[model samples]
Target: MSKTITNIHTIDLVSDFKEITKMRLAVSVVFSSVAGYFLGAEIIDFVEVLLLAVGGYMMVGASNAFNQVIEKDLDALMNRTKNRPIPSGRMSVNKALLIGSTLGALGLIILYYINPITSMFGAISIFLYVSVYTPLKTKTPLSVFVGAFPGAIPFMLGWVAATGSFSIEAGTLFMIQFFWQFPHFWALGWWLYDDYKRGGFFMLPTGKRDKGTAVQIILYTIWTIAVSLIPVFGVTGRLYLTPVSGVLILILGLGMLYYAYKLYQSRDEISAKKLMFASVSYITLLQIIYVLDKYIRIWI
Candidate 1:
């Protein structure tokens, strides 16, 4: 039994790496950072990209780790998060804090190497997430508003990291992502209303699953589409969308809005899941299209 327990501990430490949810967050943020860099500058620095990848991972992973720690009890009550490390007792809160602190320190150090502005942004992201967003989750639906700032950072953090400055280019990147978060989160809130209820989370307005929530979802979806199309008319310097990319982005954005509308009409968990999935693909695909447009122009 002792040996068995030791082996289980070993496995859990390995699983902690996975449980922190760093990889997925890193992938998403790195892609956006790359897209932002591609948008803002003619030249790419492989070193800055490396720092962005590593630093972004540390900051985001630390936030997720702290989130799991703060939500450990609540997570146990929710079906989706019940198996998470701290909640399931697979990893200790002490272990989580230790790991989170180490990762955060390393991330800040690496980002400082890239630029002071990037380092500051990374620190602020962690602050907003662990301090502001996590605690606010169960308090009010306004948590989404507070959370949006940190969530939207990656879209522009990359540009600032690359350019060592802020401008309309970085601001444009931030705008698209800021608008996108409302629908993404509200759709998940709808899909997980019951579980969130068990966890004491007030995820939407009126604190209920209803038509008002669905309408808000649709409104945010429309706003996201509007923000996404802004660069098409050449407003953000080198970040302009080519005709081909503009058409592609519009088609993708509308596709997401279509799913959002479907979920609003149905208000069913399955359709909410569908809308959430569509939102995921929409953001990922939009970033890809933006990056592709950047390289395409270089070639042309």
Candidate 2:
């Protein structure tokens, strides 16, 4: 009976540690990146796919862990993040830093197993994300642009991991994700502008949810939808999107734009929150659809 109780306590402690590691978010990003790789590959390489999954998970995990480490104080101030392991005293800074560095090193090593270029990119991503993007979040809204560089890499990372080189297809993938991030993140900024301000993070452009910021959100959303359909018109070359896929992409984009437009019209926090949620769903579903469109191997 005592041993059973002890085991339960141990499991709970491990769970707390994982919460700090941001494993769930990392897993989602890894899934999307691997799906991109499989879809983009001329011939799927399981080894490269495996390395991507592992490497991507490690890198993202490291980023989140270090983020928690940096924001421990600010995290303690906010309702949404106050109970995270570092801020809640469930884990110490030293422990988190050690694990983050170890995981980051291991992630790069795994990428190197695929190729040196991949390993180099993985290292650069970690440096930019943890070192630059993290600190800049409190300093300027431009952090969004800086962070976008790392955020956009997963899609093209798939292409690189597959082809051992970058090309038009990779560039197209990068551009699609790059444009999609602005509206997605800006919507989040809209909703969290207050909390972010309290934490000294100038997340929203113009520092307000006014017409100018809304206009930018709506414009970027339009571009996101347009780019998602580029492959259908032979504009993306090797990244062809069929007529049916194009229709679905159009529907997804319109659905997302509807929410963005609504938020723009209202400038209400609740509306911004709705748009933010919709953006998450949009990116996730769009990636799933793209992979499935290819998986079924139908022209449509």
Q: Residue 266: error of model 1 in Å? A: 0.8
Q: What are the per-residue Cα lDDT tens digits for candidate 1 across 267-286?
A: 89999899889999999999
Instruction: Write down the lDDT of every candidate, Cα atoms only.
Output: 0.86, 0.84
Best by lDDT: 1
**Model 1, 263: alpha-carbon shift in Å?**
1.1
The estimated TM-scores of all candidates read 0.95, 0.94
Q: List, in order, the clash count of every candidate structure.
A: 0, 0
Candidate 2: segments with Cα more than 4 A from true spot: 298-300
- Weakest 10 consecutive residues, lDDT, candidate 1? 33-42
